[model samples]
Target: MAFTLGSLVLLCGISGLLTGVWSATIVPVKGNNCPKGWTQLDCYCYIYEDERRTFADAENVCNILGGNLVSIHSDLENALVLELSEAGGVAPGGGIWIGLTDAVSEDDFMWTDGSNVDFTNFSGGEAGDDDGDCVAMVTDTGEWVDDICAIPLPYVCIRETFRH
Candidate 1:
């Protein structure tokens, strides 16, 4: 009976020590690791607010926050944008500017990350480049369309991680 009690005490002490270490190292620092009005998704942080700004201006804002305008490249990314849209209470009015454009040329859409465009979630027959070489996310239609990148519009920003 004494041996069992000693074993239980030893286990409890080890668990308490581990819990202390975890709380000190693993617990996130409020507003430091993640900024105010932002949420952590994977290794990135995202702000779902709707802000009216040009694509370049949006990029600047994101840069100031150690991030960039949102760029969608896969089904998972698409779903994440849809989720953010819903969370931000954005309605179907105007399209939100994303970090995609073919401003260099037609059919040459590229991401700001210097990566080639691999995924496209544009609406049917949209992104026809009738006007500009930029892409925007339509809230109502939930699709991408080529537009003037310089035009000011609501946009979502993506914050990258900086591990120290």
Candidate 2:
């Protein structure tokens, strides 16, 4: 039987899934690497903004800085984010906006940077209960909760480390 291109692509997709060959969230950087104030992790760079702003406003700020709101893909990243928040002087139990949100389709969270939703560390019963659409990490506990998008909070931004 002759194999069509579509069938070949489908087979490759299924094979990748079965083999656990998924895409990576970190964007590889070259040359210059992260700026002086940004923290580098693997190939991605992150920066914590202490000023509080609404979710949309925070994202807009990140866009201006050449990145999007930070997306946590693993426990290590989450911990680092928590540490960053603390280092940035977030108040006890204060929240920091992350990139996860379900605004487009309620209860269906996605990263603002278009990364796959492969990992999550929400607190118990979170990402639900109609708590608006945005997500914020409780700085003191590193636990995540869905919250109102309009609420002002500090946030982190992530981007590929700068290049020459």
Task: Write down the lDDT of every candidate, Cα atoms only.
Answer: 0.74, 0.89
TM-score of 2: 0.78
Measured with C-alpha atoms, the lDDT of residue 157 in candidate 2 is 98
For each candidate, how many residue pairs have backbone atoms clashing (under 3 Å)?
Answer: 0, 0
lDDT of 1 at 138: 80
Off by over 4 Å in 1: 1-33, 162-164
Give the candidate number with the greatest lDDT: 2
**Residue 142 error, candidate 1, Å:** 2.1
Report the backbone clash tally of model 1: 0
Residue lDDT tens for model 1, 89-146: 7776567777887778788778865656778888885467468777888877678888
Against the true structure, what is each candidate's TM-score? 0.72, 0.78
Q: Which candidate is the best by TM-score?
A: 2
